[model samples]
Target: MSNKSEALSRRFEAAFMPNYGVPPVALARGEGSRVWDVDGAEYLDLIGGIAVSSLGHAHPALVEAVSRQVATLAHTSNLFLHEPEVLLAERLIGLLGAPARVFLTSSGTEANEAALKLAIKYGKANGRPYVVAAENGFHGRSLGALSLTGKASIRDQFGPFPADVRFVPYGDADALKNAVTAECAAVFLEPTQGEAGVVPPPDGYLRAVREICDTTGALLVTDEIQSAIGRTGHWFAHQHDGVLPDVLTLAKGLGGGLPIGACVGFGDAGTLFAKGDHGSTFGGNPVSAAAALAVLDTIESQGLLEHVKTVGTLLAEGIASVEHPLLKGVRGRGLWLAVVLTAERAARFQTAAQHAGFLVNAVQPDAVRLAPPLVITAEQVTSFVTALPALLDEASHD
Candidate 1:
């Protein structure tokens, strides 16, 4: 590492909490699906900052938007209205092609937090106070969001959490139906369990969940923080099953690398949170909202949705053609793909691939999740595929 890099890393460790441990590299800069370490070594940013950089590093549109907005008006409290906030909300609702209202925040956790509060209010209004979530599903780290998350390792440390939260087996309609009672207020789920190694639900699962929610009068809440915004080919992953969620939580790529989150509600559920029920100081700040608008505009103008679907298919097929036993198969849609291995060697493979000039994420011990920017090229996918066997070989030895 350079002197500058070492000094910065040391300062970072000293100043920041130790929850995530040490970061592997001190990044200097990024551009168009690639990032450079402080030492000037470049690597393909395959994970896209955990699926946040939808337009990749430093897209011109995003750069221009943030720059212009910061100069014009960066922030204004919720006491006043802002043009970017209003426009972005309209864009989100229009994108969903459904009647919805939006509540914006600064991060995915906050988005889920708002959704949780909305669920509670909606339930109380309708005489149901219980909430049902799926096993292995991840929401966020805040108290309410953490309570709904089904991962024992994450939730175990924080409890005893709020009561009346239940976990049902994901993709299991029977289990979901059995768990959701008429007293349930909502059913929270991830269309594809991204953190659980990109586990896509079984066919008809989402539609089935929708049916269960309807039958039980429970609001269907889909946390799409990791899967929405063209990451999954469709605008939202739930659309693959022709199902519509009552409440949808989005973040990650919504701001194209800038931090932003949105909780959108449909129908009467949209009005559950009255004026003072929830609010955020920095939610929908003009700068972040402008950044989101630029991302949406570029996604449409550049036809990134079709690009995601096309290049994503190529990447999946190319990886599968590698023909390695430890390599199981690819799951997920659009630019969001996960390479599954037979054993828990994901961290090993991740290190090996990093050395080979690619950045990836070990979402689990047995899987590496790939969420490259929607703008990533076919050539880059081909290069990564070509380098996979060597990465696997090194991982196998480790």
Candidate 2:
């Protein structure tokens, strides 16, 4: 580490909580898909702030939008309406191809929390008491969203959560059918489980779940925080299965790099939350909303959805073709991928990749996640694939 990086690390440790552990490198700045550390060493940023940097770093459109919005008007509390927030909500609802009402928030957790409150209200009105979620599916970390998350490692420690939340195995329609009853108020699921190593459900799994929810009178809430915004070569991952959710939660890539989230409710689900049912102090601030609108507009004008499909295939196929003993295969779709290792050496693999001037995430014990910027070029994908064999070899030796 450089002297400056070490100094910053020490300062971070002194000032912040230790929940994230100590980062390996202190990043100074980024452009496109590359970031430079404080020591001036450049690394390809494949994680993209865990799928939050949709347009890469410092893109012209995002920069101009945020700069202009901040200079004009930044925050207008929900007490009064703002043009940017209204435009953003309209754009999101139009993308979903549904008649929906939006409740904007500051993060994915808040979005899910809003969805949970909507579900609880629906349950109270309908005399249902239970909410079903998928095992190993991640929603968010707030107390309410955490109650719906089924990951044991994170959820176990922060217990005494809200009651009547049941978990069924992901990708198993029969299991969900047996678990969701008439008394279930909602079923919260991830179209693709991002934190669970970018695990995609089986074919037609979402359709089956939709049918089950329809039969049981349970609202289907698809948490698309990690899978939306052209991450999976689609506007929303559930759309790939031709399924429409009653309540949809989104964030992560919504504001390009800014903090924002939305909980969109369709049909009757949209009307459950009346005036003053819920609100956020800084949910749809003008700055974040402007950034989000720029992201959506750029994605459409630049044809990034098709670009994601083409480049994602190249990256996935390139990693799969590498004849490395430590590589098991690749999983997930589009740019949201997980390099499955043959063994539990993902941490070592991440360290090795960092040393080799690339940034990836050890999302699990045996999976390294890659959710790069939507603007990442085919050339960048090739470069990463070319370096994979050696990185895997180093991790094996380590």
Best by lDDT: 2
For candidate 1, lDDT tens digit of each residue in 1-398? 67878898899999999998888888989999999998899999999999999999999999999999999998898999989999999999999999989999999999999999988888788889799998999999988899999999989988988747999888999988998988999999999998988999998899899999999899999999999999988888888889999999999999999999999999987888877999999999999999999999999999998999999999999988988867988888888999999989999999999889999999999999999999999999999999999898888884
Q: How close is every model to the real structure, measured as TM-score?
A: 0.98, 0.99
Model 2 RMSD in angstroms: 0.7
| Ten-residue region with minimum lDDT total, candidate 1 | 155-164
Q: What is the alpha-carbon lDDT for the whole of candidate 1?
A: 0.92
List model 2 lDDT by residue over 1-398, tens digit each: 87899999999999999998889989999999999999999999999999999999999999999999999998889888989999999999999999999999999999999999999999999989989999998988888999999999999999989857999999999999999899999999999998889999999899999999999999999999999999999989998999999999999999999999999999999999888899999999999999999999999999999999999999999999999889999998999999999999999999999999999999999999999999999999999999999999999994
Give candidate 1's TM-score: 0.98
Task: Please identify model 2 stretches exceeding 4 Å from their true place.
Answer: none
**Candidate 1 error regions (>4 Å):** 1-4
Superposed Cα deviation of residue 394, candidate 2 (Å):
0.5
